[model samples]
Target: MLNYKQKKNQPLKGNRFLISVTVLGSSGPIRFVVNEEDLVGAVIQTVLKSYAREGRFPALGSNLNDFLLYCPISETEALSPWDNIGSVGVRNFMLCRKPQTETAIDVEKSPSVSRKATGSWKTWFNNALTLKISSH
Candidate 1:
């Protein structure tokens, strides 16, 4: 990843690189040739425009700021708008809508029950076989 020092020395124009961006829930990753000096915000705008053309996203009325760009491998970190694309490295990244507070709560609750049920069945089956063998 390019750091602040490298970004400082880079020119704002004439440098372009291709990167893959996967829009969460979309068909697949889209390849974009972006200028090295382009801000993250501008890059997102370009992505949104392409999605709009493809009818993958709604009209421009939607707030672009509500979406975030994340490195898929390190999803917890979001790239800042002030940072240029080159600074983040030219690689595959993810675009997702920021989760709402209510939806976030629901997401946390649904998986544990399924896991518990699966474990419980395995434990019960093993105990039953153990008891049958002991009695025999």
Candidate 2:
């Protein structure tokens, strides 16, 4: 009974594990422990806090919604904010700012100049390729 009581008094930390999150454009990754059941969005917030606390460089602002988290293996798709970190089953993650959306005016301008841009691009590419092939 005494052993059981002593065990009960100890903190339960089974669901927690250390994870390393690499902030894009930062010099190094941030290592911290987190609960497996914690949501991805929550994890990002925690990572940001830790980064700022440590005074890491490139001063990322404090906007949780401005960032996205990804597993290195599945980089094409960011992990959903609603998903649990444990669901990914990976200890390493990458955090990057959400890409800024292009404005409608930019899209409209592209179509008018696309033909000229394509011609220049093709010419530049062909010349570069030719030089490389000729050197071999």
Candidate 3:
């Protein structure tokens, strides 16, 4: 029988990988490219830099503390609100990683005015109906 650790360390041939990244702050997934041998740190840097180039900055936990990277092979599995990753890999493979979440996102929300005093009816609209009369 194959040992668990032995089986886990099995070598892999040159294979293209499926890289999926989930950015915490932005609330979504991310993408990356690597030859597998590259350290997980490199990929994370690549992701963080990509967003930084766009003028958005998020905290990479690994930078400040021992943030462990966990790569879930199955996307269907449920993850918590704070389960970020910085896992490792070897050989040729695809990577599914999360982008660094932007702490301050520029949300494009239009200025909303309070219509609380619009009588008993819902009459909060931009264009108002007008009635015209010819005083002949």
- Name the top TM-score candidate: 2
Residue 132 alpha-carbon offset, candidate 2, angstroms: 22
lDDT of 1 by residue, 1-136 (tens): 2222235585567578888877765766678898787778777776777878777743433456777787755547788877788887657777776654445566588856433222222244478679989999
Ranking by TM-score: 2, 1, 3
The number of residue pairs in model 2 that clash at the backbone is 0
Candidate 3 positional error at 7, Å: 30
Q: How far is 65's C-alpha from truth in model 1 (Å)?
A: 0.8
Per-residue lDDT of 107 in model 1: 57
Order of the predicted models by lDDT, top scorer first: 2, 1, 3
Per-prediction CA RMSD (Å): 13.1, 11.4, 16.7
lDDT of 3: 0.38
Q: By summed lDDT, which 10 consecutive residues of candidate 2 come out lowest?
A: 1-10
Taking all chains together, each candidate's TM-score versus the true structure is 0.60, 0.68, 0.35
Report clash pairs, candidate 1: none
lDDT at 108, model 1: 82
Alpha-carbon error at 67 in model 2, in Å? 0.5
Write one digit per residue (lDDT tens) for candidate 2, span 58-87.
Answer: 999878888889887784688988888888
